[model samples]
Target: MTVGPTSSTWTIQTRPPWFFRRVVTNAAAGGSVYLADLVTPRGMTVVVEPAKISFSTVAFNLIVEVDLSGVGRVDDVGIKSDYIGNHGYLSWVELNGTHVVRSPIVLFIASPRT
Candidate 1:
């Protein structure tokens, strides 16, 4: 389904506070990583970018990981790479812990549909 900028609801999931902290830390350190949701099969694609104020070459990957405990099945997951430039990477995994699925998370990061 195509999402508009003003859409109130988003399939995008959110992770717990602690886990989010860890993700932030990792991104700040310029680590190329993936954000996974424990509840849902689909998750956000993350890419870390260096901040202008930093001298250590640290980048921030601001991908939000959703919590899917109360949800049901995940049909499909995808992203648009151009949304956040060339650094974004989106992915997902099955809840059964048997399969790893990767897709573009940001759809037209440069031009999100309004």
Candidate 2:
């Protein structure tokens, strides 16, 4: 999602099923970078548990590992960044399909709407 600082804080959120790689390019004037958070969907709970993110803005190639735990429902994911007050805007967020699986802790069944 194309994003500029929505507020003084540098936090951005996206749709659920957060299994993607995030790339915020053109991070000029001290952009933001922090742990990635998931917005749990209704009827779903955090299963994998969120992971803390550590990113270095020195070069921007630093890879960050974030964990998402949930099932049954899909919700928007909020991303946090250490560097705030950034003049730059957000660029892209790609999902990592390698780990997009149902949580072992929660068993979900999709029900059709009448």
Residues 1-114 of candidate 2 have per-residue lDDT tens digits of 222222232122222534323332323333334433344433334322224332334334333322333333222212233321212122122243121211112213322344
lDDT of 1 by residue, 1-114 (tens): 111221222233333211211132221333233324222223333332211111132454233432222112122234444343222322333233343433332322233346
TM-score of each: 0.19, 0.27
Once superposed on the true structure, which residue ranges of model 1 sit more than 4 Å away at CA?
1-84, 105-114
Among these predictions, the greatest lDDT belongs to 2
For model 2, state the Cα shift of residue 112 in Å.
Answer: 3.8
Note the Cα lDDT for every prediction shown: 0.28, 0.29
Every model: Cα RMSD to truth: 16.4, 15.3
Off by over 4 Å in 2: 1-19, 24-26, 30-33, 45-50, 62-110
Candidate No. with top TM-score? 2
